[model samples]
Each structure stands twice: as C-alpha cells, then as structure tokens.
Target: MSSLEIVKQYYTSFNQKNWNGMLALLHPEVRHEANQGDVRIGTGKFTEFLQKMDESYEETLTDMVFFTEPADSRVAVEFVVNGIYKKGEEGLPEAYGQTYVLPAAAFLELKEGKISRVTTYYNLPLWIELVSKPRND
Candidate 1:
C-alpha cells in the first residue's frame, strides 16, 4: 500500500477502536512522540499508551486533511478531536463525562509499509478549558 493509504488505515483503525488493527500497521520498533509528553519506542510502549488513553478518554477524529511528501515517507494529518473525558487523568482536571473539541495534528513516518514513527500535537490549554467546564446534561 502507498504511504497515504497506510496512514488512512491507521486513523480508520483508531476511529474504529481497533487496537490490534492499528498495531498491525506499525513497525515493531515504532517510535511515538506523545503530545506534550516524552518520547517512547516500541509497540509494547504504544500499547500501554493506548490502554491509558482508552481508560481516560473516548475520541474520534473529524475534519481530517492529509498531506504527504511526494518523494519522502512522511505524512502529516490535521484533524479535530471530538472527545469525552470519560475518566480523570493524573495531574489533570476531574472528569464528569465532559466533552471537548480540539484541533490536533499528527506526523507519521512509514517504513516497509508500516508506520515507524508518530508524533502528535494538540492545544493542551484549549483542551483543559473545554474539559474544565462540567457537562450540563
């Protein structure tokens, strides 16, 4: 598959909450750079991160726009995260099923048809403000 197709599948698996599918597309020694967090390597570490995220949030990506380098193995995706703060995370605000919409972006590098690196970014302050407000319903 082409780099663009692989990246698309990655996000599709994410939206479907298919953890295994997502993992299948990743390189064994995948490098992950979490938004505002430390760098982590390997699928095992990625799985741990996914588990933690699954525990604290339920999110879907919307308004996705992808850009690829014609002669490189890089792909960049811009999207908005529509999410619910299902559970409270450490060092963050309490969660009361609060909802949030935040703009986010991810940069991915593909190697041998698998994702080898992923770096994600998002507005932490905006997310904090949105989730800080308790849901009315």
Candidate 2:
C-alpha cells in the first residue's frame, strides 16, 4: 500500500477505536513520540499508551487533512480531536464527562510500507482549559 494509504488506514483505525488494526500498520520497532511525555518504543508500549488513553478519554479525529513528502516516506496529518474526558488522569483536572475540541497534528515515517515512527503534537494547556471549565449540564 502507498504511504498515504497506510496513514489513512491508521487514522481510520484510530477513529474506529480498533486498537489491533492500528497496531497492524506499525513496524515492529515503531517509535512513538508522544506530545507530552517520554518517547515510547515498540507496539507494546503503544498498546499500553492506548489502553491508558482508552481508560481516561473517548476521542475521535475530525477535519483531517493529510500531507505527504515527495519521498513518500513521511506523512503529516492535521485534525481536530473531539473528545470527552471520561475518567480522571493523574495531574489533570477531574473528569465529569467534560467534552473538548482541540486541534492536533501528527507526523509519521514509513519504512517498508509500515509506520516506523509517529510524532504527535497538540496543545495541552488549551485542552486543560477547555475541560476545566464548569459545564452547565
């Protein structure tokens, strides 16, 4: 599959909340550069991250626009995350099913048609601010 196709599938899996499908596109030694934490290597670590995220939040990517490098080995995607904070995470605001919308982007590197590295970026403070506000409902 083409690099763009692979990335499209990656996000499709993510939107579907299909953890195994997302993992299927990754290289065995895939490197994940998280937005606000240490780099995590391998699919195992990625699985743990996904599990934690699944426990704390429910998210879907929207307004997606994808860009690919001339070499076809690198892909970048810009999207908005529409999410609900379902459970509290350490060092973060308490969750009362708070909903938030945040813009985010991710850069991916592909090797042999598999995602070898993924680096994601998002505004943490903005998210915190959005979720911290008291909801009328």
Relative to the true structure, candidate 1 has a C-alpha RMSD (angstroms) of 1.2
Per-model TM-score versus the true fold? 0.96, 0.97
- lDDT string for model 2 (3-106, tens) is 99999999999999999999999999999999998999999999999999999999999999999989999999999999999999889999999999999999
Error of 2 at 16 (Å): 0.6
- Per-residue accuracy of model 1 over 46-135 as CA lDDT, tens digit each: 999999999999999999999999866999999999999989988899999888899999999999889999999999998999988755
RMSD of each: 1.2, 1.0
Q: What residue pairs are clashing in model 2?
A: none
Residue 70 accuracy (lDDT) in model 2: 93
